[model samples]
Target chain A: MSIAEKLNTYTTGPDEQGHFGRFGGRFVAETLMPLILEVERAYTDARRDPAFKRELEHYAAHYVGRPSPLYFAERLSEALGGAKVYFKRDELNHTGSHKINNCLGQILLAKRMGKTRIIAETGAGQHGVAVATVCARFDLPCVVYMGETDIERQQPNVFRMRLLGAEVKPVTSGTGTLKDAMNEALRDWVANVEDTFYIIGTVAGPHPYPMMVRDFQSVIGQETRTQMLEAEGRLPDSLVACIGGGSNAMGLFYPFLDEPEVRIVGVEAAGKGVETGEHAASLNGGRPGVLHGNRTYLLQTDDGQIVDAYSISAGLDYPGIGPEHSWLKEAGRVEYVSATDAEALEGFKLCTRTEGIIPALEPAHALAHVAKLAPTLPKDHLLVMNLCGRGDKDVFAVAKRLGADIE
Target chain B: MSDAAVATHLAQTRLEKRFADLKAAGRAGLVTYLTAGDPDAATSLEILQGLPAAGADVIEIGMPFSDPMADGPAIQAASLRALNAGMTLAKTLDLVAAFRQADREAPVVLMGYYNPIYSMGVEAFLARAVEVGVDGLIVVDLPPEEDRELCAPARAAGLHWIRLATPTTDDARLPRVLAEVSGFLYYVSVMGITGTKSATREHVAEAVARLRRHTDTPIAVGFGIKTAEAVREVGAVADAAVVGSALVERVRANLDEAGKARPGLADDVLGFVRELAGGLTA
Candidate 1:
């Protein structure tokens, strides 16, 4: 309780109207406003009920594998030869990523709201597979919208979603990427407002979505706090994570926001370079605009038409980041940096060889930053990075990028 | 004015004046919509200049956004065509300015999402919209909860703050949607986006009657209105029938395979608007 009060002073966000310092608000149409409010009310009530808490805890412990380990990367730390590096092993959770942490909470809320259908949008298909898994567990109809471009890149996870009894709809609009898939998902939500619950895959939608998804994912930071104390006998010196709509980063950063001694950094994916104008680093390269039901920094043209974002990792190829991250960036509470695709590839190779852990390309961006920053600090400095996703889903793509044909 | 009429009269803007003129004429008006620079800016301006002569009472020029989530396929493609032809928010305002030069009687509304105006800076855009003689605004994403963002400021700048009341807007939610509209309350006749399935006439009548119980604002029903008979059926219940996708679809149908406007694109679009207006005039 004291920690909550301490953190509240650093993070005063998403007021009742959901404005995170002019970054987030209810920017949806009138048809979805009432239903959005309904979801908010249901979530608020469920948050208060002890039974809801117990059910969520039970599922987190037994189903989704809560309390993912914080392991000291002895070999990687030695290789960097500066800061001691620790990897938060969220990639070990069910479905091979931290996405299930949010999906578990949202699907439970959907069941509580008596919603018969579940719909979601995915970029790398990790969130789609997570949502399909939870819906299948809860015995609900699930539909996932993925862009045609992403479907071609992430075929394995798409097959996983279909195997879990979810309908995967291929979105063929605009650039046919994550933003277009999100637009199509919103269109479906509008048409099916009565019986559907839209489980936004990240911390970026209208009012309650940004706030609710953040709460669901905060377990990562909370567990990290406890484990870091037990392991190092004190809080870490720094935190690093990748940003793709920023669910995992927000999760790992929310609990430690008030710790002024700790430095937090969010890494954005720079496809080629920030100067190339083809990257997905919103805060680095974009101006503030509205899209996907929230006001956030968006990669757009001078006339405010959203441009397609490019990244080697499909998950980080979205044009906008989470609105709360926008607020945090402006507030200067977190340092934002970018890593190019070449750097991420280098980091991926280093981690796989040294630590025997193949990381998802999304978090490879963070590892790239860690590789640079760790060698600059003292050997005793404790730096933590969220290895947010496993690399199995990205293996084929990485092989193709490395000029190897994996049959 | 009676109490209800006085309550609806929030401003002496062009929309209020136009609605009063229509009431004096003893018939509902016809509202037509078009993407501002569809096919090309010159042709779009010509179509805009000819709409009043084609019997359009209220004209809506859609600002083309790269992502039109609330629009159906027809308007979505129309937006793409306009954007591909290099239509911009400034160009859309320019079209309105050019239209106001010839036909100053019909009320003009700029309808779309909020990003373009937000990107332009709210004050600058509002000043330009007023400079171009735009009557009102209908930003679909800016609900009443976000009134402080654009609606209130635009209304104070002399542009009517029109809002939407969807079919899902029950009795509890109607007043919130109604409270922000100083011009006309746009009633989305379906629970979906533009060009999708339409609402039943009985449902719209009941919805309009219920809205009348709440406010005396002029009601304009839109979405899924294709033909003159459908417009006539909707006009029988509401103060005006707003046809958007159908008219835009006509512009699309007249385009060549290379996506350029074939000959007489404006004439084909105006002829459709003229036939749609005949629903009330006949």
Candidate 2:
């Protein structure tokens, strides 16, 4: 099914209770439910209020540096096969990742809500940095919870967060990865509920957040739609992006969800392998459960305990995808697949050597699909891949795996 | 019913009387953990129904979360089972609402992460929980730092905000934890993941003993108290015995290859509950 038609079946607007395909419902605890409902009302009001849309547009254009370029990878296309491939270069986004697009919007919402404190959780540290950057811009106090393990792995991001004036609290609990960091962040929010605004990095959290983050990131697809049309005189046959909480993919895919002619693919991290029990392929191997305040497919045991997830990239190590993606999978509107760690590594290196573009490990999962799809597709068929972030942060890990000397 | 009603009912519910009965009988109470609506609401009701006969004195119904950090694999799986069974706060309350129709004697505590409650709007949840005859709430993720928000509303509603005391809690934190709470103190016997088993260490006994030093709140030790021997050891110190993951883990392990509930599984569930309850009293 086409991305556009799938989008139509789901929602670009709120449901009666403000859900998007059962996944994006407001399933929070009773205490936060009213606040969430209020936020939903506010978001709905804001979306319809032209001033709010204009302000968001202003921030996107000036603060987030929107209209991110759509670049054709002619060299890589030739290197892989003759089929053409293009990249929606979100790496060049203001915070150096696609995260800023959503952060900018959420921070604006926080400002509009008259909230003063901002709390966020980070895995690879990209979203933390983005939230920190916006918090700094808005002069809001930002506390970013990061897992200790992630802090050690992504030191440069920790430094960047510090540079942005956000207090990066290292979460020491439960394997200390993104999920743990998120738990700590949730703890912080509950403790500081009166004044704190949680800037969720993805389209997963209960009500409004999943919808709001998707709207912010939807700029990717909106821009992709316009750019692809301008650059290629037509839309690509397929739209692909990696799915960790599915914000980036949804961002680019939602605008095109109605375009039946345009296929949408979400790539998930398979870690070592899907069968290894050491993977982050939640949609592929997970079941539906309520976690982090939303009813979604999760990497959980039968008793509802969250399983620690694995991935070569810290960014893609989440055990749940955005609930919207879960609904999409159920609807079979978008095809969800996984690429193993080794496959992603190969895709990362191939993009670097052939196109001189070092793609983020998350996106490398989608790029890895190029190897399979490009070889199979007719030379005339085109693919637009959302290059969600840069791989400079992953160089050390990638080089270590490849036995390359960074020096 | 509003959270106010539930809170009032719980506050008026004879918890002190229940304790007196336990002491007179020379029996420690059996606390069973079941995900609200496991195997769907009907089966959950069945499980809850069988508990009293199988020997549950206090029942802790888990409100499933998308991310359950305090749980190990077993209870986590059970929560997923319940969630798949279409458990929601409304549905869980409905279960409690239904359970209230038959039994008002057993003090029912809603145990799970705080996110669902927080998301539900504390006032509304407190009101609804109170209305449904929910006696207490044990939010694993709610730290003492934020209990004021949860506890104050819950207190006003007359619902006991049961606190979890872990081994890591300092002497200084214990008083604050005990201050505004009632019903029981959930003494998490060990640290680390919920399901990963460790020998119920000597340290757990010490932790329970230390809790006894501070407040007189009935203390129930949970988190990996699976086997009867473990329950007996814990029950020796704790006022009440909490058996969770082990019992639920059995259900998860015995799930049909297709992850469905096999017919006639009630015997297996009851046997496990009975054995654990037997150990606690013995």
Q: Which candidate is the best by DockQ?
A: 1
Residue pairs in clash, model 1: none
Per-candidate Cα lDDT values, in order, are 0.92, 0.79
Docking class of 1: high
Please give, for residues B126-213, the per-residue lDDT of candidate 2 as tens digits.
8898888888888764555445547778878877778777665668656766777787777766544565655355877788778878
Candidate 2 chain A weakest lDDT stretch, 10 residues:
A26-35
Worst 10 residues of 1 chain A by lDDT: A1-10
Error of 2 at A301 (Å): 1.2
Expressed as tens digits, the lDDT of each residue in B57-161 for candidate 1 is: 899989999998898889988999999999999999998998888877789999999999999999999999999899999998988888998998998998888
Stretches of model 1 off by over 4 angstroms after superposition: A1-8, B1-12
Which predicted model would earn the best lDDT?
Answer: 1
Every candidate's DockQ is: 0.83, 0.07
Q: Write the per-residue lDDT of candidate 1 for residues A1-407, one digit (tens) a residue.
A: 33333354656677988888778999989999999999999999999999999999999999988889999999999999999999999999999999999999999999999999999999999999999999999999999999999999999999999999999999988878999899989999999999999999999989899999999999999999999999999999999999979999999999998898889999999999999998999999999999988999999999999999999999999999999999888877889999999999999999999999999999999999999999999998999999999999999999999999996
Per-candidate alpha-carbon RMSD to the true structure: 2.6, 12.3
What candidate 2 gets wrong by more than 4 Å, as runs, is: A1-8, A12-14, A405-407, B1-110, B113-282
